[model samples]
Target: MGSGVLCIAESAGNELKKSAFELAGVGQRLAGALGGPISGALVGEGISGLVEGLGKRGLPKVYVVDDAALGRYTSDGYAIALKAVVQAADPAVILLASSAMGKDLGPALAARLGCGIISDAIALEVVDGKVHATRPVFAGKAQLEVEPADLPVVVSVRPNVFEPAASGDGAAETVAVDADLTGEQIRVVVKELLEPEERTIDLTEADIIVSGGRGLKGPEHFHLIEELAAVLGGVVGASRAVVDAGWRPHTEQVGQTGKTVSPKLYVACGISGAIQHLAGMSSSKCIVAVNKDPEAPVFKVADYGIVGDVFEVLPELIKAVKEKKGL
Candidate 1:
């Protein structure tokens, strides 16, 4: 049953999310490793031409579930549509981003297909024609290796850890599948998505993130964090303490209870790297910890460390980056 791998394309604002490319890269590589073809599945309105971009990212086939029912995300609609396509494609491996949407639907789809599902994977490999996944367990304290015994192994992955992939010479070939709605009534109808107080880059997809904590002192000083983020073309993030204290918006909080981040550079300002906080960003490529306390757990994982007050250090760091880039 080793057919191929399919990554569900996700939208970032109006276009394809970077994580889509990352998964396409994974799918393409896995297909090559298994001597199979790489394919993708697209579900949404007005995304016909979107498959062209997917083809350029190494997808040979783009299965489109084009219908009015797919205009908005309804759990049942998505599960039904995806189930139809996957059953038609007969794929042995399916990949999805470990984001809110993927997390919401992966398990439901897995249950529908009667297959094993793995989520929030940090690493994946196809060995001897079998998919093996590694993911954090016990809140980032340890990791577990999961080898599904089912033919169609469903995987949801952390974004940004996989290397960014460039365009390829592949062409998009469309495949049509009949829609089904077996669980449509059982799914909750989402009325609306909450309007973010300040819509910034999603923590999961940010290239650079500057996060603050209780050490930022108060809500008024978050402006400093925002200013630094502006200087660096990064997003300002915060710990749960800061968000719970109303010092910053909950949208900016990065922790187990909030959004998970895997940026190229995750600069922790005044954060002590609580396990809950580490669970969100421990997968980042490069970590920099800036805090007054020298022995903070954040420093242990930091590639670069600055043992100083964030208030005193942040301005200097911003000035240096600006000067270094001649901003």
Candidate 2:
């Protein structure tokens, strides 16, 4: 049987993403239980510089797939490159971050390797020498533990749920793998990349998020949400209702249908906390809800709840945060 864990490291704009370290943390834990070495797979163009950082996070060895054709993420291109590393390393388990790219890449890579995959796993443990995964089910209403029936299964871990491993003074040994990719192999060609007008932290990786819902009544009042987020140095989030009503962009939506976030602090302003919305952020370390309704469902899942109008309460909360930071 194969042994050890391999982390599928991801990067953007040549910089290592926070999820890369988070994946390393998960790999280290699983590798310790399996009593095997932990390695990493780094794919992309000119990403050799990131190998040293992964080593400091406990991955002493990494397989790199570097080529000019992989300047952007393409499902077919990445899957083909990763297949080569998987063949060389033959890890017992593969771990990936459940981000947008991972959500797409995980299934493709698993299909290529003809292995079973568990997506959006919140926790992993070794049971009787086999890797068992725990993931949310039924819209975060319950938890389910699954064990793959075969060896070398793939798992996509929820972002921010695992603590990022601390970096150490270590370097990694890199094995270069050729990314034998061609334009004909990639069915989809990304003509251009459109950057968001406002460059903010990805919701899944944000430490703090301030989300607004329809209770704000209109898009004109979303400034309240933006101001609070700015004061706390957090990303802005929105509920499905807000997005559907054109009050916020779909990218900012936080729900089962939107981005799943587990930030350090989640502030819900004017949100009633639908089950779908809760499913996305229920894992947040601390949740603070503000609404006029005394029995809003948001309070049920919140660490703290304010039973008052957001218009009246948000200013005070923002003021308190500013004072605390002496801003």
Candidate 3:
């Protein structure tokens, strides 16, 4: 029988990603409920520095597969490496973050192991000695509770949904494993990586997000949104309408057809909240809506509503934030 919970840790530039910590916390809870220890699996090159931190964050055991070929992310290489870890650990439950890497790896790994997988899970718990997961469905319109049908179940959790586990005094026992993957096994190779010039926090991982809509008038007015987000130390987001208008990139668009974000504070500027837009950010902890239209749909879900023009309100908000921060 499978035993314990194993969390697949993801990293970038040799540092653990935020999703890794979140999934670790999820794994910790599942392990506690199952009365078993939680372990972590890291697959990358020169990632030994991350192992100690993972251990401190309540993981008693951490499996490391540091290979030069695994430095850059590829589906086959990562999948094969993770397969080796799963075989060694023999975990009852496998948890991964619902990031790009996790989404790709979770299903592939599950297919290889012949186990049921729950993807984009927002919540997980042990009910009646079985793992039960809650995830958004129907384009974020509703949520469904699911239980994996097979042993050694796999789950990919949504990023930023779960709080990270706190640090502890216990040191993690590190175990290095050999995947022994050959050149032919890795079909896809990354030729070049082109990063964006202005690096902003990922929308899925940002704590505070300030989003704009068509009310901004044109693409040139986006500076108003950017300025406010800068003062608040938050990322800038956009409605699908503006994205469709070519005012902003699709990467910044938030809606049923775009990325889903659950930030701590979501500020909607000039947005007339369509259901599709709300589907993406309705799960935010606190929503502040600013719009000229008093009855805008976004105001319905906002914790605080401001019936004012974004151009007029944004400058004042930015000034207040700067003053408060002594910037």
State TM-scores per candidate. Answer: 0.96, 0.97, 0.94
Best by TM-score: 2
Tens digits of per-residue lDDT for model 2, 1-327? 678999999898778899999999989999999998899999988999999989999899999998887878889989999999999888999999999999999999999999999999998899898899999999999999999999899999999999888989978999998767877988876679989898888999999999999889899998989999999999899999989988788899999999999999999999999999999999999999999998889999999999999889998988998999999
Name the best candidate (by lDDT). 2
**Model 3 root mean square deviation, Cα atoms:** 1.7
Model 3 TM-score (2 dp): 0.94
Q: Cα deviation of 323 in candidate 3 (Å)? A: 3.5
For model 3, the local distance difference test gives: 0.89
Question: Candidate 1: lDDT of 282?
Answer: 85
Better of 2 and 3 by lDDT: 2
lDDT of 1 by residue, 1-327 (tens): 758888888875558988999999787777777677778998877777788889898888888887776777877888888998898788888899998899988998898888889998898888887788899998788999988887788899888878755887878898877675444453666677777766777878999999999989998888878888888899989999999998888888898999888898889999999999998888888999999999999998899999999889999999998998899
Residue 87, model 3: lDDT of 94
lDDT of 3 by residue, 137-204 (tens): 87677899999777798899888889988878768888999999899999988778888777779999
Where does candidate 3 clash, by residue pair? none
